[model samples]
Target: MSAPLEGVRVIDLTHHLGGPLATMALAQLGADVVKVEPPEGDQWRAVDDVRGESRVFHAVNRGKRGVVLDLGTEEGRAALHRLVDGADVLVHSFAPGVAERLGAGAAELTGRNPRLVHCSLSAFGPGGRRGTDVALQSESGLVAANGGRVMPVPAHDTVAPWIMVSGILAALLERERSGRGQVVETSLLEASAALAAHRLIEEDSGEPLFNRFVGALYRTYRTADGAVALACYAPRLHARALTALGLGHLLDDPRFADLPSRARHSDELAVLIGERLAAEPSANWLTALDAAGLPHGEVADRPFSLLDHPDAAAIGLVVEVDDPTLGRERATGPPLRFSRTPPRPGGPAPRLGEHTAEVVGVSVGAGGGR
Candidate 1:
């Protein structure tokens, strides 16, 4: 099947994680995306390089042509305007008001091209101070909620891109009927809030939901060999787990009778369960859990272990691409699938100014700075 955005064109003016990830998804959906960088290139390109190519940059910038336009100069800004005039979408990640100074603001470009889908990505929403993943996580209560330990994964930076994609797609769908495009805005702060949405609820007494531990449920326990996560939260599942682990006597214990009671005596109940689980290897516990129809997973120490797992490959979650500098690379595949218009994984990320002449009819030397 043909790709959904086969004929669409996107002008990418994003840097770092959020905006680049969104534009990368557009390219995966078969859009003709032209990634515009300043003369020095995206600042992220200097971070964590492999053979002079930024692994951080390449991870989110696959399958797009690249051009280096120094938006600081009139000539460079003018070149960007020419690309925007004929583009279907434009995405930028400038600080709140920097886009206007660079002449890439939504109002000016969208006014010129009434059908343009202009998307602005920010660290924080308008009128708020600029922020980052760590700051937003703190402001959104994620840090406090997660026991005051900083998260290893960049939750806000990762989630904001998908949020941007959803907003941009909605705008594009609306344009089909209205014949006019609109501005789409998303921020890391908003994405952080979305991550904590479920935890936002509170009881009348001001007690937050799920704040207390509930026995041996919804947490990881160490086994003889490794660790396994158990999630027998519901009453029925809890009974099954007890029965499966030869602890059926606990089903009738007064202290472990219900959710509230379990929370009150969680430490004792956990000791009972953890002791039993530690008697066997993770494989044995996983097998028993599966037979009981309980939810569980054997925790993997390395995150990249999933790249080679058969389960991930079965769902097309892994893909391989050939990079000019890094050779063959294994990364995540396109997450969405359609029966009629399936999305395809994009090719390798382009070299800096790789398509400048082909795209703009002139070669801009690869000098540093915009």
Candidate 2:
């Protein structure tokens, strides 16, 4: 079976995680993605925290061909124009106005190919005063929102790529009907703002109660080993939770009988539940919770290592790539899966200018040729 985007050609001028992830998604859908790098190559290629290679870079740029060029040079610029001339999409993450300066802006590229989809990624959006600024995680409100809380992660950077990818796909579908391409834009700020959609709604509702309460039983509790997150919001489940914890007598107590009253005594309830959970290990509690049909699970304590995760392997989340320079390495697989034509690992990350000669039809130094 043919891939969904088998005939589509994408010129990827993106660097770092966000843009590459977007292009990777397209590549997974069978788009012919040609990654164009500067003479020095992407900065992410140097992130060697793991033993072998930069798994992060490999994860995002799989299923695509790589070509390095000095875009500042006349020859390189000319070659890039040639590649864009036949391309269906162009993905870039340069700061505001940089693309225009490089003569590869949305307006310029779309003028050359009217049907070409141009996707731009940035730290901030094009509208704000900091549009051109490359703000780190703290400036985007992402780190702040998640920090000092129970959950902490760099959600903005991690989620921005997927959002940009979705935006690009939507733009491509729109082009199908309109026969005219438009610029698809996403930013860490915007993506982060989108993530706060729920909080924004709650804030707008102007209800103090909505902000403060989490129901009585639907919260985190400490177990003997670690912690267990439990959700017994409904009356029946709450009763079951009480019985499972040997607190069935609390069901008769008027202070913990109803939802509103339970909220009022949440602290007391939490203390009681904590005391009970402290008596048993997390594994025992998990088994008991499962038997009681209570929604609870042991909270993992270890940091997430991508290597050898069962879900990752079962769903093809990681793939092995044989690199001519780095030997063999395992990196993340495509985020999407197609029933008809599933995406395959194209190859390992290329060396600087690895395909310059092949792409531009000219020979370079030794170990490089057409």
Positional deviation of residue 216's Cα in model 2 after best superposition, in angstroms: 5.8
The most accurate candidate by TM-score is: 1
lDDT of 2 by residue, 1-370 (tens): 6677889999999987777877887787788888888765688877764544566777678778878766776677778888888888998988888788777888888888898888888776754433322354456554465563423445665677788777777888898899988888888788667767666444456566443353557877887778888887766677788888889899789978866677778888888898998888888888888999888756667766655677789998877888765677777777678787877556776555666677667732213321
**Number of the predicted model whose lDDT against the real structure is largest:** 1
* Candidate 1 clashing pairs, residues 3+ apart or interchain: 40-369
Which residue segments of model 2 deviate by more than 4 Å?
Answer: 49-53, 127-140, 147-152, 202-205, 209-220, 231-237, 325-328, 363-370
**lDDT per model, in order?**
0.87, 0.75
Steric overlap count per candidate: 1, 0
Tens digits of per-residue lDDT, candidate 1, 1-370, equal 7888888999999998888999999998989999998878998888887788888888899999999888888888888898999999999988888899998998999989999999988987866678888988887888897899778888998898999889888999999999999999988988977888876666688675774557478789999999999888776677778788778898689988776787788888999999989999999888898998899888998885988788889988799999878999998878878789878788999888888989987865445532
lDDT of 2 at 9: 91
Q: Any runs in candidate 1 off by more than 4 Å, and if so which?
A: 202-207, 211-215, 364-370
TM-score of each: 0.95, 0.85
Give residue 347's error in model 2 in angstroms.
Answer: 3.2
